[model samples]
Target: MNKTENSRRRGDELLESLYNATMKLATTTKLTNLTFQQIADEARTSRTVLYRRWSTPFDLLQDIYSYKAKKLFDGAFFDELKDNGSLRKDLLQLLTVYQKVHTEIGAEIINNYYFLRAQDKNDNNELLIHKQAVEKHLNATKKILANAEKRGEKIRKISPITLMLPYDLIRTENLIRPTNISKKRLTMMVDEILMPVFVG
Candidate 1:
């Protein structure tokens, strides 16, 4: 292979290794116990390599969260949005995926990091990284909503800030316990609770 091709392949390999190591760390270790050294050892690389690519453990963790969130949304949410056609159907699918990720992985990691950073007042960079990662996910959802708007679908006229309420409510366990929310119920909630405020 040419030198340029070899260099690209090496870069891809490094990213794959890093991603695999991060996934292992996310699933296996509590956020409090995850360390750069642990990740490096798990990936079969050295601390220096990780440090060369990421400024701190938080940076590495942020990259991992971003990667996982993107993968989940791309695999299910985006695909459903593209195929579902109707705005209501797309929004319901989006909400289901959003709730699952928030309650399952995203909220746990983010809440842990937020609590940790709050206790460590000196860790401004960690807080900023976490905030940015969250904003990126939120912005992607907004873009999807915007696309719906472009398609002549009526989006609720609620404040953009309130767009996160449904997921936040689910994450906070406001709904009945041990009950799976049906797509029809989600659609009804959006239409009844959010639509009058957002779409009207």
Candidate 2:
């Protein structure tokens, strides 16, 4: 490849590395516990490079979440849903993946972000950006369900609030003490509680 092309690839790789480091820190430590120095060290890049790219830690976090969400949801999850061709099955799969990820790592970052945002009212931008990303994900999921409804398929009507409630509950329970809630149980809950309101 040309020098310019190689340079561009290198820059992209650097950004990816920085983002991965930030996400690792986010999942493993509280937001308040994270430092630019730590991120720089973890990414194998200098603080100057990170600062030039992101003005603040929040900006770095915003980019990290955007990258992680895209990596997690857009590719395999969406593809599997499209291929399944069964609305209920697809929704269940989506929820199952979400539940697993949230319980595993995503929930910690999400909670930490909220906790930090609460401590500083001036730090609304990071929280807003994170909230918007979440809303977009929910809207996309809703659109999928809407399409299924249009196809004459039966699905329970689900408000964004209702959809997120059980997820929050599961995350909280897991955080307190790991639970053995099966995917089947979650699927049943969605079918029984959410479907009734969403479908009719």
Candidate 3:
């Protein structure tokens, strides 16, 4: 490979390693206590590498969260979701995939980023990060509802808070139980909770 290509590959590898280390640390360590030194030690890199990029662990995590969240929504699953034939099926499939993605990204990491974001009331950039993530989720939910409308299903004009239900519900659920949230409970979320509010 050319020098430029080799340099790009090396940078990508370092980023992947850093992201992996941060996520792994998130499970056992609180974000409140996370440090550049810990991440460098875990990633087997120097603290200067982290310091050069992020002013704080929260900043680094924001990038990591954005990176991971993009991967979740960029999948073709949602594009084919409208054809699932029923609202309940669509919700179950949606939440199930969300659960899997959150599991893969580390539920603790998801929760920590959100919690820290929520606690920061003065930072415009932090608020922007949260808003951007929320918009992506809301757009996905709106598409599902819009598609259902095309299918002749009754779509309600719910509030923005309600539109955020799918993201919040599964995020909190997966964090609470980690890998232990049963498919049965997932079905109940679709049947007992989501269907009534979104459809009925």
Which candidate gets the maximum TM-score versus the true structure?
A: 3
Residue 69 in candidate 3, Cα distance off native in Å:
3.2
Order of candidate numbers by TM-score, starting with the best: 3, 2, 1
TM values, all candidates: 0.53, 0.58, 0.75
Best by lDDT: 3
Q: Residue by residue across 85-104, what tens digits does model 2's lDDT show?
A: 66666666666766666654
Which of the two, 1 or 2, has more TM-score? 2
lDDT of 1 by residue, 1-200 (tens): 33333324447687777767766676778766778788877777667777877987767766665555554434343444453665566556667776665555555454544445555667655534445545655665576567778878777655546766655545444234425556666677667754554453
Clashing pairs in 1: 156-198, 156-199, 157-198, 157-199, 158-198
Cα lDDT tens digits, model 3, 1-200, are 33334324457787988889898898889788999999987877777778888999988888887777665545544554545887778888889877777778666667776787776787655635455666777888887888889889998889999998987899778767776788998998888899999984
In model 2, state the lDDT of residue 127. 38
Better of 1 and 3 by lDDT: 3
